[model samples]
Target: MTASKDGSSRNTLQSELAPRDMTVTEEDVEPELSEFTTPVSPLPATERQESICAWIWDGCSMLEQQLKKKAIKTRFAEVLESEDAVLAAVTLPKFKLRWLRTQDRKDKAKASLLAECRKLVLDQDQQAGTSTSTPTCHQSRDSAIEDEFFSFEDEDDTSSTAESEVTDYFKSGAQEIDSLNGFALIKKISLRYNAATPSSAPVERLFSLGKLVITPKRNRLSDQKFEKLLVLRYNHWFNS
Candidate 1:
């Protein structure tokens, strides 16, 4: 009985000496996401709502602007749909008119001549007022009117001459065409056309496929066959 009592006391002493399990409590352990969670700026309820609304409105405004820009780019309006309008814009007749107006020999010459005619008329009118004889006054007034008419006729002649020169310049051969102002104008227009982005990843991938298809072995493939093959390769439903 004493041995059993002693064994029990020893077992209790060993158990008391054994390491206890250290349980983690809420206060003892830090939250795993405590470092990641950022403290939000404190704001009044109404002010926070207003800020959120403003952010949403800003996003909507940006989306609307993008949609409007896309519409303008893709929409075929009445002006753009007209073949005559397209031709006129490309040929740039209005541009030619503005260009001619800046020339030293054309517009400047006409302006100076017109100014001289006005001065002459003003001088003659003043002389007619001062003249003693009635017939002399009438003759001066008639001559001034004739001079004004002649000046306008001269301007028309100059304009027709300029148009002829411009026509002849455009009709000239390869050497002359290279030196033309119209070539430079077309170059500027081409740059604007080339700046447009009307393609995406799918189109780019199609081009890569084209390079593969147009190899030395398949270089003789007809345009129709090439197009059909490309369409079939890209569209799974078509092949199925």
Candidate 2:
């Protein structure tokens, strides 16, 4: 009977200790710990969308300021009619998926672009001490004055034809747009936005060059020498 009691006591201790050991082993497992681990994604969906939209708006404003064209305020509205058009033109599958996922807010993005362009124009006008009034807004008043001076009833028809030409230009396909040469302002805007570098490759290359130049052996090289070396290294064709 005492032996039976001893066996019962030992069995209970083993049962309790077995669970504690199993729990410890599970805690050590990396995959099991993943349940408690934080996510690896850089940003949540909503925050990521806002970040990308902000970047697009900032790029639009910067490009507009750089172009310094009078008609740039309406250029985005003319070309980027909606998100669908831009997405259709995209060739890469990855980019298309990304655009559909994050930049699906067509109306909001378009409005943001237009607002940024307008702000850019207003800033430029203020800087130049020119009137902040938009020229397109005063079109009717200007036309009334022009009609009195020129006194031509067919002027409206001519204006309509010119507007059609502009519309046709925007509706042009990628190949047609590439072939265009005379539309400098349109091409400038397209080139600025479309021809953007996808990566910081050139900048990264410069950093790599700096690392090579500033090694222990040449640690004392002056900034001027470093600059010269960088130019010569990048433009090695000139040396030959």
Candidate 3:
């Protein structure tokens, strides 16, 4: 049990709450305490769903703000298209099964991935005759080549006079949000994760070139033309 605190300053009492002290402390704490009861009555299933939907909206908003601060480089990308907020507008059924329960497995998978990535990076670096001078983010090219996983951010950077811009943004926004702690925590944790696939530009280009090759007006294209376009698209998509 956490200590009851002065809500304004949120300073906990140095002394334990004796019975007599409760009359002043507990009574004075009417509004905030009224909102937070230890034995909260269970809300109905529908009501609970509504509550969570609202929470997700706030979570998504916070995510957008954080991403803007990070300059994620693809703010208007189709896949990310305000989908976070939309998912939050309803009780997300998926998270209860997939994301929430898979952290341990994900962590294990990340470790394995990190190892493989290090080996691949180092092998390529050695072949090319280069090494890491410093590690950036969770892993860096040169350090891994020399068999070391290092982080770029120093102690001062981690906890400096100027906090991480993303951290400060969420700390300010999260309080206004309902039950967004998990979402915020996930974002912070995701900062260390940098596993990414190839560029979207090439993927888009392949699709563009494919569409051009197979004209929509041609309701029935010749087999040879279709095969040529398919092979060409795949070749460009992967070979790049």
Report the number of the highest-TM-score candidate: 2
Please report how far candidate 1 places residue 160 from its true position, in Å: 21
Q: Encode model 1's per-residue lDDT on 1-240: one tens digit a residue.
A: 999999999999999999998998876556856767787765777798999999999999999999997798578566554543443333343332233333553444334333433444445556876785455554677787888777866556545544554455335443432344644333333244334557697778788767756779888899999998777766753356
Encode model 3's per-residue lDDT on 1-240: one tens digit a residue.
234435423433433333454346656788788788677456777798998999999999999998895675365354333433322321122332133235664354334333433444445545654454444598866767665334344333433312333234334423323433444333323333322445898667666777766776876988897878778767876689
For candidate 1, report its TM-score.
Answer: 0.20
- Mark the regions of model 1 whose C-alpha exceeds 4 Å error after superposition: 1-66, 73-76, 93-240
Candidate 2 regions off by >4 Å? 1-195, 237-240
Give candidate 2's TM-score. 0.22
Alpha-carbon local distance difference test for all models: 0.57, 0.56, 0.49
* Poorest lDDT segment (10 consecutive residues) of candidate 3: 88-97
Give the TM-score (vs. native) of candidate 3: 0.19
Model 1 has a clash total of 0
